[model samples]
Target: MARAHWHFPRTALAEHYLNVFDVGISSHLAFIAPRRKGKTAFILQDLAPAAQQQGYLCVYASLWGDPNAPHESIVQALEQAIDACASESKIKRMLSSKVRKAAISNEMLGRVEVEFANNPKSAGTRDLTRIDDLVTQLEKAAKDRTILLLIDEIQHLATSDDFSGLAHSLRTLLDRRQGRVKSIYTGSSRHYMHLLMSTQSSPFYHFANLHRFPDLGEDFCAFLQNKMASEYGVAVAMGSLVKAFGDLDHSPYWMQRLVERLVTEKCPLREAMNYTLELLDAAEGFEETAKTMKPVDRLVFLELADNGNPFSRALLSRIEAQTSNKGIPGTVQRALARLMEASLVSQIKKGEYHIEKPGLRRYLEKQVGSAPSR
Candidate 1:
């Protein structure tokens, strides 16, 4: 089997945007990226580095809430982060001494504090009295400065109204303490974040610097390739790289999975290609793209996904040939408009429509035939 092309590996953010995240550049930065583009990785890699270096307390909370009670997710995450930062002996000592001093029973705190010796877990399991005390402790712990609150997939947090109220509460504390607390919000859902910020009526409007993670580029691909060669000894050739990129639908997470598969299976390039395509077919959104779309819409996307990445209207017309016997140009345009509105396709480079989602692209290509662009 032939050696397949492989792309350079680097964090998605390291691909485009460059900044140290210093003063005046709003401590609040909101990250938006396509799903599986390493949004969480960026949180761990890029943001965590700066926060740790600055000696800032970093609290990571998943915005995806529980169905039962979701209101205090961030608050809970912060508590956990604080607890985890404590040393094991320190936590044990604190629990024993604090409980003894307060005359509190072991049952009140529930689980042993030993489990929460990790940074985030420490505050996570605290009782109500402990929660009130934790806030005061954090205020003192910060040396009157702010703790960095990092929330991941923030769009999951209730709504802007509820989040705004939380932000307002945080703001009140920060204002009173004078720069003792800061926050960074991140989300993978671009449309949801846009909706939250588009209206000034929302509480979090203008709250953070909106930074978009761009597509993986040559540098990132190169880094990834070298890392594979050095660390995993997987010699991914240029051909495999191109093939992987073509099949990847351009998501970092899937790309990483591809790398892991290659290294683990020791599969030949041809086998890897087949495996990658299979993975794409089995991915989450592919079924819906193939099942839900109108035939014309599916054909339009298939052609775009295959040929132009961005295809011409003339090309779209050709793809929709089955329905064109009706001679309805306005109807055809509206169909494309609907696909775009549904985010099934996006304008790649003016006039040229491409399937916006990687899963959709693979599904469309696999189902309907795609006409090569002229």
Candidate 2:
């Protein structure tokens, strides 16, 4: 059987961002969006392709690809980009070196191959220096063409102390290159992305234009409905498809799963929607995660969910009463730390927090009756 494919048209938005770069509004940009929202897909499939067509050398990297050592991915991507611009003989020599281990695939370097490496340690100063040198080499090799770096999960650089030197080196690279080297940094965590771009102490602070990546809206919904009916011979109602999309917070990643269920299982739309919700809940580990939290932490989480101020005296008093604690400040502080460590909450700024998973709020509200308050 042939593979099914779906192409989402985001070329217009891609062009808009590139145009911002071309006009000198900013040579670097930071795109913010939640997980499973197709940020990576838009970058790899749409933006990179558009930039390449506009005579730019695009090198794509994902920091999350190697959670331990993201710089390795950056190094590999730059090396691949350098090879892409190398002479035919040089490319052949490079290919020859690796051919004995694995077959030489033409498509591997058709665009820069972004792959993760297994290095237990975080990137050191030396590794960052090497990446900086590789960027310089790629820029030189590209001649007059602009080198556009599309970095995904860029928040890791800011959140992880190990990548500080790399972040500085990258900022310096972009600073020196000016118009010649541009970057599009994408991250799923808005809180961490803000840490990268908003904190004055951060290396990338105010370094790039920040934009919230829009969701795959009505167009994507209609496309999925039509594509399933025409290509897969699956009949799914448009309203049900839209509802499924909404139920998953408009995530194309999950919507694709719904489409697969509809086509392969020949399930009814309602059944597929329920299955998708189950998959999402399971993926989030909703109930299991809640069980692990202490009562104080859960209460603090509820307060954040209800948009209540964690630092306010009234909220603190309420938390104190609920948890039977005397030291409200210390108790709340520890709860915040524990919640953040579990990835359930994110500190947007000093005295402010956001529930990392919005769906978790709904789940908790369902599981715990009414919202907790002062």
Model 1: per-residue Cα lDDT at residue 212: 76
| For model 1, the run of ten residues with the poorest summed lDDT | 114-123
- Steric clashes per prediction: 28, 0
Estimate candidate 2's alpha-carbon lDDT, on a 0 to 1 scale. 0.76
lDDT of each model, Cα atoms only? 0.54, 0.76
Per-candidate TM-scores read 0.67, 0.81
TM-score of 2: 0.81
Those runs of model 2 whose alpha carbons end farther than 4 Å from true positions after fitting are 1-4, 86-125, 299-303, 306-334, 369-374
- lDDT for 308 (candidate 1): 51
Off by over 4 Å in 1: 1-21, 65-69, 85-137, 158-179, 227-233, 299-321, 324-356, 370-374
TM-score of 1: 0.67
lDDT for each residue of candidate 2 in 289-339, tens digit (9 for 90 to 100): 767777678778888988987777987877777665653788889989998
